[model samples]
Target: MTIYCDESGGLNAGAMTFAAVMLSPQVAADIHARFRSVTGLRGELKGSRISLVERAYLLELFDRAGGRAWVAMARRDTIGGKPGGAVPSDLSVYAALLNLAVGRWLPETGGVCTDVVIDDGRYDPVILGKVREEIQAGLGAWGRASLAESHRSDGVQIADVIANSLFNIAAGSPRAHRIQRIIEPMLASKAIRVAELKDFG
Candidate 1:
């Protein structure tokens, strides 16, 4: 099974989007449990907020998850703008990156996957559609893919908080925020940030 985590912006930046995708329920539960244990979390990891403990737990989870995990960034694409005018929103860009990550994880059989989940947030169906298209294209004609979106007021907040902390850990918080300005637009539309074992450049 493969689980992915990603982020849309950094701390230097004002806002960011992040997400996590897992194919196996057992693995997902184990990852969540490990993180909770590290953080000493007694309640649900729902909502949009995360504490320092939670952040630490996530780092540990990543370490155990292995390095092959995938990560993608929506940094300046050489033109200081979206790759193309058609994908103008941050959500679309995030979706595009998600597509790329999922593309990389497709099984050889090209079977359809439907256990996917996305956090609830501000975004348009149009951008989501584009992301869906990208995911399908990535799978080719062999396998199929499906999307599932859900709301957890707490999880959303937790995702944002954790994402910011991860960015800080990567570099300095100051730089992370600075990068946020440039990266937020790319992440604006994502349901949540995804995580991978590899570092982003």
Candidate 2:
């Protein structure tokens, strides 16, 4: 299986979300092809750019295609205990959330190997490398781990949608209801795992 990862929001936002979608290679490719054909979307498929109707269609497609996702969320208001308490850096927040989400959704089992692909953003190479090392260490004796860019990955696009949806829900956006409805099936099936962190220090 392959895990495609993407993030929504940032340190300045009300909340941050990291989402990962898991799918077999064949399924991922098939989903990408179907999405393009159905929506006629050119270039990369980003949630922020799509219409509500399109989002619904994509979510339904994911359900029918057996796609699974995991989401990690951190609310800025609840990050620190006090007004001036120590807070974790963005990279730290990401790494911790990622670790928790992966552990829950794709625990290190001596079975099929799982590869991870993350959206190409502004992450520092050193920090990203360290995160990769940590993940591999945690998965020792189960399977090897590697991280790659999602520039040309369709799976990552799917992850982006999940991240954005989770972010909206966490922020209590008006569109949350619609997004939740679209993803309710995944939640009901436990195909979409969520980790909400209150402390990052």
Candidate 3:
């Protein structure tokens, strides 16, 4: 399986989220094609740019595609952030969380090799490159990690949606209530694994 990674939220929202969405290559391509046919998406499909109905529909596709997700969240009023004017340290925690999320699905035994693609939307190439290398060092011989722009990646874009949806819920956004309804079944069934980083700095 190939896992796509992305991050959402920040200190301004009192939280940060990093998510990994795992899917077969074919499924990822299919989902992208289907979503585009339905929405006529001209450019990158971003969670922040989509409507509630579209969000619901995408989640439905994820469900049907049997997509699995793992998310790590840090809740702190003074935590590292990737918002405007972000520092390199701001991505340290996010990288840690990304590692945690991807580790969840990695096979501990047997020979298994998986690809990890992270969205390079938040920081400059050099800093995010370091994060990619950090993740690479941990992948062992069974996994590979790399960074890609979300707009160019359907998997990364979907990862963004997953991260964004949960961020809204944890941040208590006005639409969280409705968004919760759309994803309640997946949460209940544990198709999407969400764990808050407890006692996190």
Candidate 4:
């Protein structure tokens, strides 16, 4: 499975949300092509920019296209590492939450190769390179991980919407009610699994 990842919310305040959506690259491209054809969106379909109806439509498209996702959030208060006025770096926090979000999809036994693609806008190339090694080591097999800009990855763009939709509610955005209403159907149907991380290990 190829898992596309993205995150929303500030690492320092409120709640931070991460999404890992599993789909093949070909399927991701086909879905986004439909999105562009229908929505007439010119470029870069970002979560924060899409309207409520558009967001719901895209999510439905995702679900119907056999996409599976895992989204997780952690409130600032619940996140660890506040002793001695120290806080976790953005990379550490992101990696931990990301690992928690996508880790469940990994098979217990090896042999299978899982590919991970994350939004690479945050960290530099050298550091981003490390993610592949860590994931492969953790997998103990032929696992691949890479980072790409959201504008370039259809699956990552989809993940951005998932993360942002939940973040709006988790962070108490004014659109919380509408976002909740939009996502409730999927939550009820279990198409997208949502988890809250109190202990981020």
Candidate 5:
């Protein structure tokens, strides 16, 4: 199974959106449990700020899981109601980042693309479809893919919580940091634009 999680509408001029994709049910549970154990997050994950420590915990979990787990990002084009000075608008760059991250988790050969789940929200299928197509095309079209609309399952929900926190952390980290600096050119380039969840809706 292959899963996807993401955040949309945040990081620029709107509310932060978070999501994740899972490739295995058992692995998903293990990931969620580990997150809860490490972060002490209780109850529903809606509208919660996953702490920095919890974010770190998940990165470690993904690292140890050694499976296909990745984060796709769309930097906000504007901040504080002002035009984003210079973020690029290349979706492929972000898509490449997402693919590279997921590719590491998927097997190099004979990998079945069984699951490609995402949070069910107002986003358009095109956005998700574009990402999946890029992954498959860049990888292979034989990979099976599906979306988990309105994910009510416990495992998927938890994955969503974990994914959201991690993406926010990576995108919102201090500008002086390494990862932040690495992506700064991408973020400051003109490839980004103000996108709305309803655009996908």
Candidate 6:
């Protein structure tokens, strides 16, 4: 199995989300090609850049194509500390969420070798390495992980959609209701697992 991961929010006083989309490599490739052909999206399919309708269509395709996602969320009050004092870095919160999502999705025993692909955002190499270590540890030493630019990775783009959709739900955005309606099937079918982290301060 291959896991593609991305994050949304977490930069300031708002909800933060990390989402992982899992699928077999061949299936993922097929879906990516199909999605691009069907949607005719020329550039990177970023969640923020696409419309709600586009988002819905893309997510539905993921559901129909056997892609599964795990979303981990942390509200500002939970991971953010006192206003003036030492606050946890965004990378730390992101790492924690990654750990939670991967740990929940992968089985403890007899799990196949997994590869994790993350969006190469502004993450520092050292922090990313730590996150990789945490995820590998959770996957029992068989997991391999690497970073890629979202523009070049269709799987990571899917993860970006997952993270953004869940972030809207967690933050109670007006679009949450509609987005939830679209993703309800994924939740019902257990294709998506959600986690909300409490105060880590």
TM-score of 6: 0.88
lDDT of candidate 6 over 25-56, digit per residue (tens): 77777777887788788888778777888888
| Model 3 lDDT, residue 136, Cα | 82
| Candidate 1 to native Cα RMSD, angstroms | 8.6
For model 1, residues 1-201, the per-residue Cα lDDT tens digits are 433334546323433334444435455556666666666766556423554445545544544453123344443332134455442355545655565555555652246443333442445666555655665566566544444343323222233344444345344454455444443433443322333422222
| Model 1 Cα shift for residue 107 (angstroms) | 8.1
List all candidate RMSDs to the true structure.
Answer: 8.6, 2.0, 3.7, 2.2, 8.7, 2.2
Looking at model 4, report the run of 10 residues with the lowest lDDT sum: 104-113
Tens-place lDDT per residue, model 5, 117-141, is 5454544678967666655564556
CA lDDT, every model vs. true structure: 0.44, 0.77, 0.82, 0.82, 0.47, 0.81
- Model 5 spans with C-alpha error above 4 angstroms: 9-11, 14-22, 46-48, 76-113, 124-144, 149-201
- Count clashing pairs, candidate 5: 32
lDDT of 2 by residue, 1-201 (tens): 877778887656677789878887788778878888988998778787888888888887887888888899998777844676765677778887788767765653336677767665649777777777887777666555565565577788888888888888887777888888877878889778788887566
Better of 4 and 5 by lDDT: 4
Expressed as tens digits, the lDDT of each residue in 72-116 for candidate 4 is 787776774566655556677777778888786775324567788
Whole-structure CA lDDT of model 3: 0.82
* Ten residues in sequence with the least summed lDDT for candidate 2: 104-113
lDDT of 3 by residue, 1-201 (tens): 888999888755767888899888789889988988998888888787899999999999998999989998876544443467453344666876887787776763245688889988898899888888877887877788888878888899899998999888888888899999999999898889897665443
Which window of ten consecutive residues has the lowest lDDT sum in model 5? 192-201
